[model samples]
Target: MPRHNSTEKRAARLVQEITGEPYTVCLNAVRARSLAPLAARGVPRNVLDEVEDELEDAYGLILDLPAGAAPGPVAFREPPVAGGRAVVRGEEP
Candidate 1:
């Protein structure tokens, strides 16, 4: 029988089961490597640099709009006629 450390064997088995890939050499020898570049083309560099430039150039002002600011005159004008009768006049029920 081979003298295999139980911990090492368990670690290798776990990695294989989790990754669904068989462990070739040893448990401690396994290494985690980036698979994004292989799976998909690597992300483009300087992606945020372009956005940073635009953000630095952008500028705006914050205005303190007063409360109860009506766009036009706030008068109690009679409402227009509806259904051939003025609703404000109480002519139509």
Candidate 2:
């Protein structure tokens, strides 16, 4: 079951009343508000691109992929090193 705080429950109720959408959809919409400010800022193209990438990761947004392409299993990756190279699991530095 999805956990919702009191504030989220109230917002979802209001949204459902206004739009007549299902509770789950309304709740998801309310949850998406976290990204609203960033989107409304009209950020520059380059900056918006970067921000969108980070927000997508943070918010678990679905990434656009090529048609008919299957997504691979999630893998853990090591943090970037000083020179900005990423280290995958089981690989030496």
Candidate 3:
């Protein structure tokens, strides 16, 4: 069991508050997004490496984001037309 420092604990808590995920999962996501910036700011390489290890350990616990949260490419499908009437899949006639 890895012991988290005060800064790490606070980071995990803040991420959980924003993302509604467990601390470990939030930590992994936050670390993944912040590693490069943190390294650029002169944070030690060894510390960053530890964070990477944590991310790898917690990878499986990360939750799937809601559909609207991370939208993928929009695919445009041809409208269905029958008997001179156009039908939209989820709209009322």
Best by lDDT: 2
Model 2 lDDT tens row, 1-93: 657676666765554443333567656645665323322332223332333454355444432332443322333345455534333353224
Model 1 scores a TM of 0.25
Q: Which lDDT value does model 1 have at 17?
A: 38
TM-score of each: 0.25, 0.34, 0.31
lDDT of each: 0.29, 0.43, 0.42
Q: How many Å off is the CA of 69 in candidate 3?
A: 14
Which is the leading candidate under TM-score?
2
Ranking by TM-score: 2, 3, 1
| Model 1 spans with C-alpha error above 4 angstroms | 1-4, 25-93
- 1 versus 2: better lDDT goes to: 2
lDDT of 3 at 27: 62
Across 1-93, the per-residue lDDT of candidate 1 in tens digits comes to 655555446544443332233354324322222222211221112211221232233311111112332222112224333323112222223
